[model samples]
Target: MLQKVPKQYLAQTRNIFHCNCKIKIPIEFSEELLERAFEVLEEIDLKYNSYVSGSYFSCINENRGNWTPIDQDCVEMIRMIKKVSLITKGHYDITCMPLLQLWGFYKENNHSLPKKDELATALEKVNFRSIAIEGLNVKIGAEQEIITGSFIKAFAVDKTIAFLKSHGVADAIINAGGSTISSLNDASHTAWKINIPDALSKDVFKTGLQINSQTFSLSGSIDNNLLIDGKKYGHILDCITGYPAENLQTGVLTKSAFLGDVLSTALFTVPATIRDEVIAELKQHFDFDYFIIDNDHKKIVTECFQYLR
Candidate 1:
C-alpha cells in the first residue's frame, strides 16, 4: 500500500485592482473553486474600482453633491471607512482623490508636485466629514471624490477567504499586489511566511513575518512615487497637508484584511509622536499589531508582532 500525499494548488490573476494577485491552497482544490475565488475579486473590481468608468464608486464620484442610490454593500463599506476616518481624525480619507489629482498621480506624463496654492485648493475638498449616507443612498461634497485604492483589494481578499472557508479549506493564503495578504485556517500549515523588503531596495529583505489565520497589509512609498526635478514624491498623500506623507513604510497585522489595509495607510500618514496613541485608541476597537519605518529609517514594532527572522 502506498501512502497518500497532499497536493497543492495555486491560482493567479493580474486584472484585479491593477495588480498581480495569487491564491495558494495546501490541499488539492477543484478548479471551479479557484475560479469562484477569482470571481469574487472580479465582482469587487467591477463594483468598487474607482477607475472603472461605470463602477458603483465611479457613479458616486460622478454624482458628487447629489444623492445617489447604492447597494447595501456599498453603504456598509462607506460606514466602515467613515469609522476609521473618525478614529484616525481624518488622516485616512477616501476624498483625497482631489489631492492625488493635484499631484498628478493619476496622470502618466504630469508627475510634478503641486504648487502651494494648488495643494491648498485641493485640501478644501479632501474631507471625510463631507461624505453622507442616507440609508441606501450616498453623497459627497461638491468637487469631492472617493478612491478605493487603499482598501478595496483587501476587502475583496477577505470576501474570498470567507468563501474559501465556507468550502472547508483548511489552509490557504491570498496575496494581493504584494501589499495586502490574507490567510484562511492555518491548522494544517502552521503559518505563512511573508518577507518585508527594504523601502529603498526591493531585493533586500528587512525582516520576515509569520501569520496564521491573519491578514498583513503593508503601505509604502518606495515603488509607487513620482520623480520630478530629481526629487521623489510619494503617492500616499496626507489629507490635511495635501502632500505626501513622510513615513516610508508601514505594516499592519489584523484578523480582518480590510482593517489592516485601512490602518496601514492611516498609520503611514500619522505623525510618529502620536502614532502610538492613535494605535492605542484603535486597539480599543480592533485587535492588531503594527510596525513603522519612519522617514529617518527607524524601525518600530509592536511587542506582539511575530518575526520569523
Candidate 2:
C-alpha cells in the first residue's frame, strides 16, 4: 500500500496539492519556512485550480472563444503543457475536460458511464489544438476547457520546491497527491527511496528506486474504476476511441515533474504506435525508466525500463 515517508523526516501540510504534501530539508526549517510553503500553495491553488468556479482557469474556460487575459504563470504552464502535448502527438491532451465530463470524471460527476453517442458528442469538444495562446492572451474553442488535474498539483510541488530553494533551503522531497513526486539535494542517504506500486496487483511494488534530482510520476485509473460482469475498467480513456485505455497504469521518471505527470497519464492511454516516439523524446532530455501494465495484465518491458525484481 502507499505510505508516506516517516513523519519525522518531513515538515508536513495539507490541502497543499489538493492533498497532503511535504517538504523535507536536510535540516529543520523555522516556522517562517513552513509559512512560506503554505503561501506558495495558496498562490498556485488560486491560479491553476480548474474546479473552482471563479478561479483564473475557470474564467479562462468560461470565456471560451474569446481572448482572455491570463497570468504569466498560466502562460508558462500552458506552454509546458502544450509542449508535452506536441511531443506526445495529442496523446497528452489538455483539452480533455469534455471527454472527462462525459465519463463522469468531471467536477459535476453523475457516476454513470456515458452512451456511445454521448461520448462521440463529447469528443467533438476535445481537441488540444483548440487552445490558442498568443503571448499573455489565451482562447479555447467554444465549450472547451483545459483541465490541469493531470499536472497542476505536480506543478505546485515543483513551484514549492523552487520557493524553498530560493530561501536558501536545499535537500527536500515533495509528493503531490501521491502521484507527482520530486526530490532535491540528498539528505541522509545517497539518494531518495521510492516504490512503484505494482500496477497489476494490490499493495505491492516490485520495483523501487534510489535517486536524487529527479521526479517520479504514476498514473493509474484503478481507483473509482468500473466493475461490470466481473470485468474491470480503468478510468483513463483513449483519446481516439472514447473508450477506457487498455493499459491498467503507467509510471515514469524524469527531471520535470510536469513532464513525468503528463507522460504517465498519456502513456497509459495512447497506443504503442506513438509510445516509442514519446519515450525517445523523454530519453533525449533525461535518463528515465517506465513500467506499463496492459489490459492483459502483462508488463511491457523496454530497454530503458528495468524491473526492480
Highest TM-score, which number?
Answer: 1
Number of backbone collisions per candidate: 0, 0
* Model 1 Cα lDDT, one tens digit per residue, 68-163: 888998888888888878887777898998888878877887745678888888888889998999999999998999999998899899888999
Runs in model 1 deviating more than 4 A are 1-7, 306-309
Instruction: List TM-score per model, in order.
Output: 0.93, 0.86
> What's the lDDT for residue 195 in model 1?
85
Q: What digit string (tens of lDDT, one per residue) describes model 2 on residues 93-131?
A: 878877866766544435456788998898888887778
> Which pairs of residues clash in candidate 1, taking residues 3 or more apart in a chain or in different chains?
none
How much lDDT does each candidate structure score?
0.85, 0.74
How well does candidate 2 score on lDDT at residue 306? 57
RMSD (CA, angstroms), candidate 2: 4.6
Global CA lDDT computed for model 1: 0.85
